[model samples]
Target: ELKVEQNPLFLSMQEGKNYTIYCNYSTTSDRLYWYRQDPGKSLESLFVLLSNGAVKQEGRLMASLDTKARLSTLHITAAVHDLSATYFCAVGGLTGGGNKLTFGTGTQLKVEL
Candidate 1:
């Protein structure tokens, strides 16, 4: 079975600060995905890391995956108020039926001025 967990379930920081969110999985995974969700909105895909050294960035957010260690990270640079949201990391594995995704406990980020 595959299980995913994230640290610092809630984060509160000031604008312009930098922080990194971690995701750890119990078993090997084929892909890692990062997502963001606002208080009352649907999830938005942020990054997809397929390989061990895969890294992707958008704006102030950067994501990386290490398949060997079954770990993924999401780094926020110069966090802004708009970045306040719930973040999640998901691990995808091949299942008997199809691909299965296991999501981590969400990290609620609150960026204040």
Candidate 2:
């Protein structure tokens, strides 16, 4: 079984602020991904961190990976109202004789004013 965890299950941020979301896994994984979901919408793939030190960014969001530590992070730069959403991190690896994605519980970010 694969287990993924994320910290700060809920976040209330103000515009022009910054924050980071952390993700940790119980087992080894070569793949980690970041996704965002708006209310009443489907999850949107934001970044795919495949190798160690892999980092990706777009707009106000940045994501990095550390395979050795089974940790990943999503950093929010200059938070804005439009950045409000639920973020998720999924760790993928061989499991049950196949590849599976273990998703974190998600961190809901609320940017106001």
Q: Could you list the CA RMSD of all candidates, in the order they appear? A: 1.0, 1.5
Candidate 1 C-alpha error for residue 67, in Å = 0.9
Clashes of 1: 0
Predict model 2's lDDT versus the native: 0.93
Candidate 2 has its poorest 10 consecutive residues by lDDT at: 93-102
Q: Which pairs of residues collide in model 2?
A: none
Every candidate's lDDT:
0.93, 0.93
Candidate 1 wrongly placed segments (more than 4 Å): none
lDDT (10s digit) by residue, model 2, range 1-113: 67899998999989999999999999888799898999999999999988999999999899999999999999999998999999999998876897678899999999999
User: CA lDDT of 15 in candidate 1?
Assistant: 99
Task: Give TM per candidate.
Answer: 0.96, 0.94
For candidate 1, write residues 1-113 as lDDT tens digits.
77899988999999999999999999977599999999999999999888999999999999999899999999999999999999999999887997678899999999998
Question: Which portions of model 2 miss their true places by more than 4 Å?
Answer: 95-98
Best by TM-score: 1
| lDDT score, candidate 2, position 62 | 93
